[model samples]
Target: MSKQHEKLRMMLTAALFAAIIGIMAQVTIPLPLVPITGQTLAVGLAATILGSRYGALSAIIYMLLGAVGIPVFSGMSAGMGVIFGPTGGYIVSFIFSAFITGLYIEKTSATVTQAFIANAIGMLINLTFGTVWLKVMADLSWAEAFVGGFTPFIIGGILKAFLAAWIGILARKRLQSARLLPSSTKLSA
Candidate 1:
């Protein structure tokens, strides 16, 4: 495909991934600090499949949609209140998580093991950012923040990270082999 075609494909893919993240957000076990949702899994998948810049762009799009009062969040909630709420840190952290995960996977040629590690690191970043935000925004103590926001989600995060790495690498390899996705297409300035 021509570079122009490739660029359009990337943009569409990013939008699709953003929607996927939004849909996944609906699968939530509502909690106090942060809802247990499939969002992190989708984030991992987007990063591995879309690469760093595109994955991060997709996350930004998702946030923008939510901020605009779109019912794209857990339990179909939306608006600026959600974006600036106690759990908003996790939402904001998604971009960095996707970017870091994608960068690591791209650099390692999307190796499965490294992908898992990268996703795990991304999860840690999310957990840390979300916890701090919870503490600051909610006026909770550090221990309370960690317990409520971080500790509660540890196992679920690991599972989602692993699933994202496994599924994303497989899908990416398939797309690459099909000539549907280029291996190294960075956005032009």
Candidate 2:
């Protein structure tokens, strides 16, 4: 594809991923404070497949949509209130998580294991930021925050990370074969 065409393809890919994230956010398991959601998995996949810049852009788009009162956050909730609420930290951390995951994939040879580790690290980042935010926002003790924000999500986070890595690698290959992926990054199978 020509350079212009490739750029358009990338833009579209990023937007599509952002929309995917929005759609996935609706799939949530209601819990106290931070609900279990598919947002993490979507963020991980977008980052691993789109690379750093596009991945971060995708997450930013998602955040902006939610910020603008779009029903993109969990439980069809949106607006600045949700973001500033106890769970807001996790939403904000999605951008960093995407960038981190994509950076790891692009900087090194993208592999399933590497993708998993990168996403796992991103999850930890989210958890730490979210836990601290929850503590301050809810005026809870460390142990209380841990239980409310971190403990319940640990196993689910690991599973989501693994799924993101496995499916992201597989999807990357398929996209490359279909020439749907931009030819800029080195994501050959």
Q: Give one digit per residue, the lDDT tens place, for model 1 in 56-168.
A: 98999999999998998877989999878899999999999999998887777677788899899999999999899999999999999999999999999999999998999
Give TM-scores for every candidate, taking all chains together and pairing residue i with residue i: 0.95, 0.94
lDDT by residue for model 2 over 76-141, one digit each (tens)?
A: 999999888889999999999898888888887678999899889889988988899899888899
Using lDDT as the measure, which candidate wins?
A: 1
What are the runs in model 1 whose C-alpha is more than 4 Å off? Answer: 185-189
Q: How does model 1 score by TM-score?
A: 0.95
